[model samples]
Target chain A: MASKPPVTPAFSLAIDAMGGDAAPEVVLDGLELAAERHPEGRFLLLGDEARVGAALARRKRAARICSVRHAPDTIPGDMKPTAALRIRGSSMRLAIDAVAAGEAAGVVSAGNTGALMALAKIVLKTLPELDRPALAAIGPSARGDVVMLDLGANVQCDARNLVEFAVMGDAFARAVLGLTTPSIGLLNVGSEELKGDDRVRAAAETLRDSHLGANFRGFIEGHDITAGTVDVVVTDGFTGNVALKTGEGALKLMRDLLRQVFTSSVPARLGYLLARPALDRLREWMDPRRYNGAILIGLRGVVVKSHGGTDALGFAHAVDVAMDMVTHGFNESIRDGMAKLATQSRALPV
Target chain B: MASKPPVTPAFSLAIDAMGGDAAPEVVLDGLELAAERHPEGRFLLLGDEARVGAALARRKRAARICSVRHAPDTIPGDMKPTAALRIRGSSMRLAIDAVAAGEAAGVVSAGNTGALMALAKIVLKTLPELDRPALAAIGPSARGDVVMLDLGANVQCDARNLVEFAVMGDAFARAVLGLTTPSIGLLNVGSEELKGDDRVRAAAETLRDSHLGANFRGFIEGHDITAGTVDVVVTDGFTGNVALKTGEGALKLMRDLLRQVFTSSVPARLGYLLARPALDRLREWMDPRRYNGAILIGLRGVVVKSHGGTDALGFAHAVDVAMDMVTHGFNESIRDGMAKLATQSRALPV
Candidate 1:
């Protein structure tokens, strides 16, 4: 009865149905739209069953498209993700667990980041000796798209963690960006070896000694984020968070400034109308929705993260990102690749 | 036949002859412009006899214009400021020493920051028992300018240091922004009381209990910097430097992006041409030249710190800022008013 799925294996996504600032409606809208596009893709919707079911029933999506799984509680954004992992009933934990247990191919959430990270770590666990999992965002760059990581996974990290991050980041880039070997850069205060704090200097030394160091392209500064000079930008959570927020704030400020300038006078407003098409094209390129979702890397299974304030369109893009990772065998590839490194090099610190 | 300086007892400003990337060219240009505007103002040029003398010889200004002092050595930018301070022949140190000895009303430098701070601190010393001086910049806000301190003075600061910064920032806003009792805000990871690290949270409590507590505006986040939500944003040197750099990088990125969009197509270029006047006005308003220099506060003598990369226009504006502070007696006013607080405050940890 239903048309064949866009792809064969029928990607299964575990959605945190109650997550995000405008959940349920937007989540349902995103799900219905994606279901319509893929027809055969299976989905496991995790949240309060009654409400999720009610929302889905109104959508008129295919009956076999999605199944409901109850997760009675939700993770509050303020709680530290590490602490929230211990609480059993959290929706984020249940969603990630579904993917880890093979009940679903991927997990998607727009919940409290700390809680999602904690849950993913506990349920899926780190790959081999990876001490910490990192959060990565795939955003628009001057070179089309680039990955930035450790956005806020762990606040403080040593050189070993950075070395591992470079490895994981490279693996993710291979899976997502499709680069054979992604060029990785360690983010610091400046490009010079003498720049940044103690952690950065030590990280640079460790990176220079590793086999992974071949693909590691020197240090990059805060301004280098959107510059598109490298495939991946690596930094500890604190600096990364500050940089991320600063970028977000800048985009918004520029948009406001542009709008004010466009509408300042009658002639300018007429010019805006005449140039609306080109401006809109430019806006689409810079829109957050086009690149909102990020993947929580260094986990046992695929887990995509949508921003807390994402709308239906953004959520739909996150679903597509998860589907892509599943089809690409992202997790298995990382595990197999890292395993070879572990056997060949005992020099890499745990 | 030099005319007598207008009858301002506590106010005068000495210009550095060998400061900034462009050196005497930009500095002298600024001096000439300011001299024309304030015909009764006085300036002392500090540098080598040949250069300063030659530059002065070229200027045919009002009689109250200039004086010159010779120095045997110059401090290059790459060397550490402290090391440069140890050299007695360095022009920057000599100019700062003039201010300390009350031979000049103020000293302004666009030279190496670390060097100027070191020389100023050593020669002028802190007000009484105050251990370290803070560099303060006036961040432009919608309501007015926010007094932000320790732009890069102290890197590692404690809870007590932040509290003192808030107090000093409040006093600064009162004197500069012309608020009788200005609002103070602590820069934090979030607006909540429990949001920041141990130091920030503890400092918030201390701020609440201090005499400056009545007008304290609580915690403000990074986005608040451009949002103009607070009259004062106080933080230690590390975070402040990060914020300042982020803003600078973001501003540059936006300008570049606008240029790219405008030149992408003929239609867009035409639109940009039509909107040029309004956009140009906005650019002028946001220009760094208009907000040229920072005052190194809490020292016994007034010192203005200019940006290292400043051009002729920026240099000119720095001169204007220096003139304003000198004429307004900024140092003596704050020192005499906060003498009690300065004496009672605990000395900085060495």
Candidate 2:
């Protein structure tokens, strides 16, 4: 509700082309697809120019709206965040720097998550009222799409940090999911108010008493994540990270089991052939590529991290998330919401 | 490895009949099924005589082995542990007391989990070396089955607590799953040693140096839960609870989506008919009844908690878990393992 209209004109996004498993190839392919989807959008591609140029030349749509900016190095997948901070010319750093320098409205990368988070936090910095940024990602639920935050950024979070996450997650859902007023729930072991640890209980108290209380749905269990019990699910990094990965693992297990079942007997294989179209639709609906982007919320500029192992389609989905944030003036809304929360907290009794 | 042959022969198990959603009927049905499977076993059925007698009248096998103990009250599912503790004659308390008095080798209850854990801890007490008890449960995995601990027992755990969990989990895997030596892993966000909090890192260090180090597999991610990367998963109650429920949520989502897909078209329905046998096998393999019990580990007596919402088959599975623990001398193995760990820890440098 606090969101304001976009003050700035349409802006270009920067891409870290030399990141992810497929590097320049997948990045270029994703860019081409994104370009066709958003014809008015422009991209500043950061990587080795020779390789990026060659990849771009093959894609007419991407070549029309994308410009290459060469970078000499890339942040390795296993590099420590502290070690990654010193690498100035790395593609991840350069793409982030583009946002800082006003050349790009946001940055998208299928790269080393820790390194990317470290670089983005340093380059773009947190919003004025927020202490730290959170990683928010969309997950497919039975009812619809659900947004969850603090995915692995701050492993140990306090009450205040959780409150901040709830605020950010609410804004994220509205911006990315196109919701007018997203309902929010704090992820807990049980739905009862007295279920979790001190930090979670305190956070729930604050949310219940805050300006966003109307949209707050109190405590929700882990099953609520996929059940779509609420539009936004807020949690500490440790629990969020584990819950997200656990869901992914379960999905993979079921998929593998389904494949084994279908291939086990001749009749089953024949049935698979007849059901291929419907099954394909189901697979597409549940595809990880559709929800590849993990957004770093509560930051001054938009930053979307794609899964490092994702293909072109997944990478393009990450780009789409960044585009949504930029187009919706997501940062401005977060800043306004944070300012209101600060004032409201100060006015309340200790 | 420290497990010994059962010294106590042919002991009866106490069942809390006045619990769960289906109450006396499901409990009676489950007892009948369990009685048929283990005809040598006897049961001390705890509930109101009128209700228990009426339910048992229709059953032949269970009526032969079960003797009813009149329990005037039942712990309501919504009652807190502290409140439930005051009600002495409740069915849950009486069942646990049966184990403490040595009338029963173990207790199985589809009742209030918090109350069961509380009463079991207060009545039966923890093993000498264990500070607190943990809730361990079997979950279906890709390879076979996996054991995860502290499902909802200890909300916060220290390094020593986690190490104790690893020890208890190892013993649990051995006794319940019939494994000689089960591989153990600490559940974390990443498999790397440096990825977790200080407590987790400290636990890993301790497990690696302890006598149980032979079975220690270092750190494992949340995905490993369903992947069956380790025989036992060690985690604090908070993360464990969230991960377990999230996995369940994902599975339910996939099942619902599949059902929707198959029912959308006439050809899909026909394909479903052709694939019915294979799909039935898959469903059977993933059935919740097969993995119904959550065991309270590190206690002096074996205590199994069935899902309150589960039907007769699920309750029977819970009884089976209790039988396995009782027959294998689970408490004795845990005691022996803990004694070894205590000796090993003292010899090392602080």
Candidate 3:
């Protein structure tokens, strides 16, 4: 194994080079791309040193900013998170260790989400105000980019957890999305005051009375997500995960149906040729690659999880997400928000 | 008020004419369309006598097989279900009363959902096995029409309730969707066995061992709903409602985005004209009107609730749904399935 990582640049991020479906090469390519955009973003590439170093040698830009670190093993996607904890030499574990050792500002991986979360919690711990960290991601909405959280992190959540997610999502929107005072909405079955269980209602009441109440939109239904009724849509992980996947499925269905229609006849094919440019515009606007990262919020350090199926550009976006959080001191913002709310009154509803 | 209803035909349905946004007119129009489809179908319209009678006079097809019943009151869309229950003479209540009194084989309404369910429970009653009725609806999937249940009917479902919903959904798919032995799945965050709550796991276990085991597909994710991974998707009403609405919202967004693309440029508009036929075909295939009814299963009679914003065609489809269930003895089938399950050890997990 190579020697341990040396002192790192301020915004350096640890890359789990052997994590994704197309590992090492895609990770290096993504880092090169990220290096172009974020000149100040340095990387500690953690993987099988021989393969990762060879790949890093080919990508001049990435090599210039990245230091190769030897990780003896790779975490398999199907392995249980608890079991993976014992595999300390794995690329994912090494990246997380870098963050814990203060060699990296944050860590990014497209590895097993469960393993990443479990490892990050143990190594980095959580922000003091958080009971559990939330899985937050940015997706396209009619108005603009909207942030959603708890996308399958904590299966069951109480009022305090929900309120915490709202706070984190709110802070994320302002930090990454550059919103002045981003509004937030709690996802419910219906917007009616009487709808949803006691947990949601209680969370709403707490948010409503707090200082964030000025930007709090009461309750939004699932449809409000794409309708862009609010900036940050917060919910328990169970529903949030289902809702996110459901949205993806619907979009996929539409895309398939549209493709079938376009190829149905010669005239339709011709129509597609003519409409290609505008359709391409639509495709670009809704590209999933542009929103590749799903971050674990309420963590002491930025922790971004890229989708396993993503390509170089998508992985680059995940790196961008981590760097954005690191540079903006996002955890500080969340802490500040919680501290202010606590001073005003107890953050939890009585 | 008029006299009591006369003896009705075998497949007679009571119409809540004052229930929908379009009122007695759209209800009568839908009946006229439904009459053309089912010459054997008869209706007893409940609303203000003069208004309903006047509307009936204009629709020759509907009038020939229908009779008017006077119900002077109307239930508001936002009225609480409990409050609506006290208004006995409201058209929704009258239609439910007609079902309870054996004046009609089923009932169709586009009224307040909460009120309809509450009133129907009081009047028509739930079948013996059900703790609460589940809402079932058909929607377009890649393979074909897929039946999903518990769509905002019973928010919190126990293991027993989920098992009941699976049985009811099985009966519904066979009788209404016309599948010989429809496959079923329990919706969860992930398809893994350990993905969902205890209730879903228990229900899966029960289904796996029961007679329905052959057709059960274990756990499925939310994306499976539109992917047509199974013929029936079973979930608690809260998640189902959110998933259903999320799908709707995604489709709406795609529709809007397509429209914008089509109108964005001259070449695009010309391309749209050329592609109009195929696009229309796609629209027809995925038409919401084609899947119009959400039925309250586990009830004594077939009770269909139409979307309030639907047109005459959509309303007619809702009637068609009700009549299909009535003719197929869907409720009887549900009872049979439950009875069979009861005979094979207790349905709930030990």
Candidate 4:
């Protein structure tokens, strides 16, 4: 007799259907494409059931796939993260509750970043001892994507925050990149131990004293973000936000400049003709979607934030990312690791 | 009879011969080109007599066109601004002192920024009623170059620092861009009045209450830096430096990405070929050298900071910028206007 095939447990994503500037349209499109790619991946769209159903019906996808869980209100995009949490009917809250109730393996949103973080903290909660949650984004580097964290998730931070981010960022690197002991760094204005503000100086001292799973590679600078300087670069949210947006604005400006340069004169245009092969190799490497989704780590279950300006293709990419986190058991691994570390010391913030 | 052409006072520029990474060579090159550009322009190269003489002979220029003023010690680039000020023999001191003594109309440097500011403060001093000096740079924008400050001159700032930057930056915009009244906007994380930290909020209130020459346009964001959303964007030096560099780095990356995109496929390369004309216009507009010089505003005399990594061409542009400021009496106009304001309010920082 043939051996019985083992059953693979099904995992579902609680997608905040009302979130995102494009709303149900982009979300529905992303969901359908993701379902096509991962036949086993399922979604529970959380929003007004009637509206979500109607939107899905228009795409003719309602009958084939997807289910709706009604959420009455939503956190406004402009509302403060702290204020948004008090609103109980907010869709972010409902989505987090779904994960906590075991209805979904993870949650995803491109909505109010602060609200998602707050709701994640309230419902999903951090590991029993974890003090804060960090938003980690994977960036396109020379080697591949590098996971960078606290990309504007926290306003103020201490030495402990840096150490925690390092720990969390390491788990992210390992799960996403399959690197056992990824090299980690504390992002600073300079690579020297004596560089940057006092907070960073304190963090550097703390990182040196701790024994993180990843290798601590001193400090990293602005250019290092793109040069593939480390597997993980940790910083407080303020600087991270500045770095991320700076990169975005720069990429946009450069794209415009190149088009102008290539088409400006006949000889330069001809020179571009000769340089065409090299340029193509670079585009595939810098595609924004390839680095779109950012995981809100330290939550009880997986949660991802897609860029607000992403197109259908980008949204699809983020969905595939959400599915990968669930399948790889990234959260469980992080929890177990932290639990182990917690036993070793009681000084951790969590 | 010929009305004697108003006896054009001998135009003098005190070159900080020991300022940049490449120092005397680039300074001499800049002075030579500047002298060539304006037959009336005379250079007072401040450095050791031997080095200046060697550099001048190498250029094969007539020594009569330039004069040398001896100063022994050089300010090391990495020294603290305050400490550098206390050291008496520093070349920066002697060079700035020349400007104060009416031997030179302006001073230019590519060396120790902090030392330059400190010595410039001690020698040239701030305009009457002015508190701290600001390093102002012209950012490339869609409308034209926008005057921004403090471009990394001071890190910690209060509302008064921002107000002074606005006042100085407005004067610059008028002097260079020929605007009767430039629009001034505080660079905040957002446009809303209450969007920024305590300092920003207080500054917004102060700006709304104060009277500056430029038309105050409220707030602008990082994206606005490139979009030319406002004529003058005021922030503390720290954020300004990060924003400016971020924009620069992003432009380079995008240029790289565009080259890759156009060359990757045959059709895209053809598109690039078709789009060649537009690209060149963009590159010429965004060239760093075109906007290379930064004015150290609020000083009693004109002081321009040329890019540390400047080449011969860039150095020439800095010289041109200094020439315009001197010809237009840029510093005096600001000193006069600010002095007028000083009589009315004794509480203002500057």
The candidate maximizing DockQ is: 2
Q: List the residue pairs that clash in candidate 3.
A: none
The numbered model that scores best in TM-score is 3
RMSD of each: 5.6, 3.0, 3.5, 6.2
CAPRI docking class of candidate 4: incorrect
lDDT of 2: 0.88
TM-score for candidate 4, residues paired by index? 0.82
> Candidate 3 on B210-288: residue-level lDDT in tens?
8899999999988898999999999988889989999999999999999999999999999999999999999999999
Residue pairs in steric clash, candidate 1?
Answer: A81-A114, A81-A115, B81-B115
Please give the TM-score of chain B in predicted model 4: 0.84
Alpha-carbon runs more than 4 Å astray in model 3: A1-11, A346-350, B1-11, B346-350
- lDDT (Cα atoms) of all candidates against the true structure: 0.73, 0.88, 0.88, 0.73
Query: Per-residue lDDT for B88-158 in model 1, tens only?
Result: 87778788877766667778889887788888878887765354678788755445566777676875577
Off by over 4 Å in 1: A1-11, A32-41, A48-65, A70-93, A112-128, A141-146, A156-165, A215-219, A324-350, B1-11, B36-40, B57-63, B79-87, B121-131, B141-144, B323-350
DockQ of 3: 0.79
- How well is each residue in B191-308 modelled by candidate 4, as lDDT tens digits? 7775666776666665655566337888777777667778888987756765666566566555666666766777666766665566656766777888889888887678987887
For the predicted complex of model 2, DockQ is 0.80
**DockQ (CA atoms), all models:** 0.32, 0.80, 0.79, 0.23
TM-score of every model versus the real structure: 0.85, 0.95, 0.96, 0.82
Which is the better candidate, 3 or 4, if ranked by TM-score? 3
Q: Give per-residue CA lDDT, model 4, range A182-297, as digits (tens).
A: 88887764575655667667666656555663388888766666667788889876556656765666676566656667766776677566666666567666778778787888
Better of 1 and 3 by lDDT: 3
The order of the candidates by TM-score, greatest first, is 3, 2, 1, 4
- As a TM-score, model 1 comes out at 0.85
Structural similarity of chain A in candidate 1, as TM-score: 0.87
